[model samples]
Target: MSGATGTGTTMREAFVATAGHLLDEDPRVAVVLAAISADVFADAARRHPDRVIDVGIREQLLVGVAGGMALTGMRPIAHTYAPFLVERPFEQVKLDLGHQGVGAVLVSVGASYDWAAGGRTHHAPGDVALLDTLPGWTVHVPGHPDEVVDLLRRAARTDDRVYLRLTNDGNARAHPVGAGFQVLRTGRRAVVVAVGPVLDRVLAATARLDVTVLYASTVRPFDAVGLRAAVLAADRADVVLVEPYLAGTSTHAVAEALADVPHRVRALGVRRDVELRGYGEPADHDAAHGLDVAGIAARIHAFTRA
Candidate 1:
């Protein structure tokens, strides 16, 4: 597959633009911005003032209001940074949306350390883990701007509770959408699963290794079936899961999926312990967390040999 690098559009721009289109096309579509990317939707807000609203930095009200709109039969799309969207308004997400059984499309940017210079307050390594606590949430971690557009459209069309995670990092190419993992390359010694924006780095990491690589954009409904099939195809019970968030986020699901088979698993992702007080760019944070290409390659090489 060809990797599309240096694309003019970014995931954030794609999401905001597509969301605006949804707002114009569908009357039921309502957007609640937390002043995070309010400017991105300024035109939409002006055109449909009642449908698109900026709650001005209040994360709690941002979610609560969306839930309220959903209750009134409007499909709400709430946008903000990951920390503000999921962490700050967690209770509102749990009670207003989850407990109340109302569905809203929650879109968040600045995944993990995407805004490394913004410090821990802006970092949200636990966003997905927090959402996992609630049941029936369709979580999507798109790796490209095109994928973001597609997933946002999909989420907007349904009333199901959805959380679309957006990040500054991305892969070279966009793959087809499905619940199962898409096999990008084949090998025999082991299988490596790359989640969302980690695909390009994972590919570079395992380039020389004799291992199968699978890419996944949607991880919440972990593709156990596809995972097992890929593992079996590689004829290697050894599996390595590379995620962008906290390590071992999908370890449980992988274990359950391969329960019947004899296998060894390794999980790689951002570290939960220790605070890296220094940050320059996303690459800087990735290197510190051993998520850079060299770091990932070193770990995967050692794991495959083991």
Candidate 2:
């Protein structure tokens, strides 16, 4: 099992370790599952049977139970694949937790096309966009296992509704987890905002270019102030957002942030126009969606030249 330190651990391992630690250290912490990562929690469940709940294949009930637990003053951590956790049980998430105004941490894996072999049934490129319709949610897309551990711990301690989107992909290095964007590189031409695991590819794509690169794990609460600051620091109010989920997911946020400043933005991410049916690997999906280093660089170069 991985520890809270998070070094050399997968994002899933970090989540399990952090959640287990929360259960051990906090009495209010409870874990609700829909059969995802159940075996990992066997020991924790044995120790705190009352708090660890597995609701079998019922995705709706999985969220309902967590909401019910939250109603009773318990903080619940709900787990499952992205499509099942966010898209399948959305109504439950909307009413049980959102409408009722209770808090629960929902952790999801198999981001976007991580399990490409599972096909469209397993993909969730619109999870963040769906969540955007709701109010008062803290959405985290961690690029590293360390960030996952950090964000999960932060979410558990609070009563806010949190979505910790973990993934099979990760960055080479972990940036400091903070409320706003962490500025990695600065330039005056344009601002390139890389969300989550796409940071590495974005850095590589823009290595020889003159652009400011900002890394964001926390996309919600959209960090308008930070984005504005970065944009204003640049010579041109041009922004390029590269997200891990649906393309243009955060474009509206960027527009709103740069409103009244006469800025331009180009958003890049998983395509929403057509469903990509074939996939050999995660990189294959990335290339198909123009999220690979070359794809990203080409788009950014064009935007900068324009």
Candidate-wise lDDT, in order: 0.89, 0.92
lDDT tens string, model 1, 1-306?
Answer: 122346577888888889889988999999998888888788988999999898898999999999999999999999999999999999999999999999999999899988888999999988998898899899999898899988999988888999999987887778887677899999999999999998988999888889999999999799999998888888679999899998888888889998999999888998878678897888888888899999999999999887
- Candidate 1 clashes between residue pairs 3 or more apart in a chain or in different chains: 4-172
Number of the top TM-score candidate: 2
TM-score of each model, paired residue for residue: 0.96, 0.97
Q: Where is the poorest 10-residue window by lDDT in model 2?
A: 1-10
The worst-scoring run of ten residues by lDDT in candidate 1 lies at 1-10
Q: Clashing residue pairs in candidate 2, if any? A: none
Report clashes for each candidate as comma-separated counts.
Answer: 1, 0
Model 2 Cα shift for residue 221 (angstroms): 0.6
